[model samples]
Target: MDYIFLNHTADIYICVSGETKERLFANAVLSMYDIMVEGKRRIEDIRKLKVDCINEEDALVDMLNEFLYLFYTCGFVCVECRVKVDEKLDIEASGYYFDKDKDRLKMEIKAATYEYLRIKKDDKWRANIVFDV
Candidate 1:
């Protein structure tokens, strides 16, 4: 599966999988955005964002946090993202302005937490991400 929702008592958890690590990271980002805003919205702007991290899990957290920062501060909602992850995380995302006052939000994701975070790459890449809501 590309991703699946997991039951969390007080927050949110998503399990993501892909044939490669890069695709897995991209899926994780998409899942986070899905929890924030509807996926059907039109994308009007494209932004290039990058992050450097100590490890795979750190890169995932930084990428999601960056999106949250942009949404909370700039009203951008990502529709599509192309992500490349190594020692550095680079993403090119197509996003549209989403006014929280006017748009429908699924939930308020406060942060992407390290608690219960896992990044595993075997035959394929898989990860579990927890978000504080």
Candidate 2:
């Protein structure tokens, strides 16, 4: 499964699964974008960024939070993304900022929190992510 939303009393949560690590990371970013924007927006500019984390959980938090920072600061929205995770996370992502007056803001994400977070592997990689929205 790609992802599913979970009800949280104070925030929101998502469960994501992928066949590979790269796919898992990409899905996580896509889920976050879905929370932040409404409808589709083409990417006018492409940007690349990287994040280094000590472990998978930290990597997850850093990646999502980075996107949050981008949106809050530059109104950047990710339309498509490809991520590679080694000792660090390298991302090539693209999207244009939505006009405040023209677009609908779906939800505001305060942060990606560690509470109730889990990443597992059985047949495929699975993660439980909670976001402060």
TM-score of each: 0.91, 0.93
Candidate 1 residue spans exceeding 4 A from truth: 100-102
TM-score attained by model 2: 0.93
Candidate 1, 22-47: lDDT as tens digits: 88888887788888876457778999
Error of 1 at 132 (Å): 0.4
Total clashing pairs in model 2: 0
Q: Count the backbone clashes (under 3 Å) in each candidate.
A: 0, 0
Error of 1 at 102 (Å): 5.8
lDDT of each: 0.85, 0.86
Q: Pick the candidate with the highest TM-score.
A: 2
Task: Score residue 93 of candidate 1 by CA lDDT.
Answer: 89
Once model 1 is optimally superposed onto the true structure by TM-score, how far is the C-alpha of residue 26 displaced, in angstroms?
A: 1.0
lDDT, residue 58, candidate 2 = 90
Query: Model 2 over residues 19-119: C-alpha lDDT tens digits?
Result: 89888888898888887788767678887989996798899999999989998899888878899989889998888887887678899889999988888
